[model samples]
Target: MADITIRLYIGPSSSDLRELVVPAERPLGDLIIDWKKVYLLAEQDSQGEMIRYQLYRESEGKKVPVDPKKSLRDLRFQAYQELFLTDACHPWWQGTTSQPTTTSQSKAPGTAPLRGPATSKRVTTATTPNPSPSSRPLPSFSPCSIELAPGCVRQIGETGVVINRDYLLRELPKSVSTLERTLMWMRQESRLLAVSRSDNGHCSIVWKQSWYLMAHHPVYISGTKYSRNEAIQIEETVTLLLGRDGWPITIRLHSTSITR
Candidate 1:
């Protein structure tokens, strides 16, 4: 069989959409390594830490990670499906304090000392924000940054739009009237924002501390009804969230379902 062609959107913090043609049976692990090579990241960084990449696909307003070991075709990824890329060890949204808090005098209880010359080298530290009343201090920088753009739901579709909160704040209108008017413009297109869920299964907006799922009102994604107990019989498109943990990290949606 001939090689398959697919479009991929790769980003750590910021994403760029691109197209590629590769063997249909190639494992995603090799593809990630190839991307790393393109970016010129060594197998291990200067700190002697192995660099690992995580793949994610946007589904049902969530970033669902893709497994690296599976073949592209086995994953059922269709042509032009968008995929996200990020460093597993050093996610940009997470803080730098992930490193062990240790001192030359002594190690913490149950903690092991750093091994080898890697310990001697000083790594770059990310700026940390002050801890909020409800949240721990957030990292100022992550290995990956999400790229967000201002667009209404009508433009992006029912899955909902993903935007960088910081970017939105910076680009927000200075006047309340402008903000209200802009939101009104968006409201004209659609209501009912799709809430974001964390990897921990908590319903909270990423990178924001004060926000939480205060209330959930069941609103149909489509005019039709759906149930987990029943098989989806309609030709209409449906985005199903499934995974071993049941965290809804992977999406299975039919592409041609839109046209039919």
Candidate 2:
């Protein structure tokens, strides 16, 4: 059988995104285990630590959970599609475990930014308690939703200036430099959560979980789709904006898998 093409997103963020071509012979679950060995070692679990991951295939504008035990051949896998791999136990959007763990935060209004990465013991989000004073202020995030493309509706907030859909990862615009610059101006961030599956009620932020999962690609700023070619810009922009807290704060890109 011919190899199937997949743009595998290790997490909700685009930074861990990778396109893979693989044989369709093995079960999806088995493949995922192997993929981790080859591509990701940073997530190595400690002794007796368990990390739960969920896979979803974007089809007809919906994210359908995949049965890892099923083979791609059995699923009639297609070529060049987006596959999202996320932590099922700790959803990125929520940044907390299925069984929530409460982290202590200062009870002062406006003392902390509602959105950001989680600390060793804190998972910050609109749902979490106020962060401590030591926590830095995140950029003012203005989030808006739009539609024109199918299978893309998750909302990712913006950092500095928002770019129009024309400049997203969709069709090429008149200038590549313009697109690059547009992306540069666009902010993105990392939302890697730090929850241990080894035991419940023992969750803490590692790699620091963040408060925002912007659903970036589909809902960036406002409008349209983004072409894969422009995806690299997404990466660079994230890196550039990560530590910046000036006029233009960093952005977090949380994209839904688009079906096409």
The top-ranked prediction according to TM-score is 2
What tens digits encode model 2's per-residue C-alpha lDDT throughout 1-260? 76788777654334556788878876676666566446542231221123445577767755677887787788887777667665544334344232111333223321221112222232445756544535845333334332212333334433222333322333223363354445556743211111111221111111112222222222221122222111111211221211112111233344442222
Error of 2 at 198 (Å): 23
Could you tell me the TM-score of candidate 2?
0.36
Q: After superposition, how far is residue 77 of candidate 1 from its true place, in Å?
A: 1.0
Write the residue-wise lDDT of candidate 1 on 21-71 in tens digits.
877787676676566545543333334434456667668856677777687
Q: Which regions of candidate 2 deviate over 4 angstroms? A: 41-49, 93-122, 128-260
Q: What's the count of clashing pairs in each model shown?
A: 8, 18
Query: Relative to the true structure, how large is the alpha-carbon lDDT of every model?
Result: 0.38, 0.40
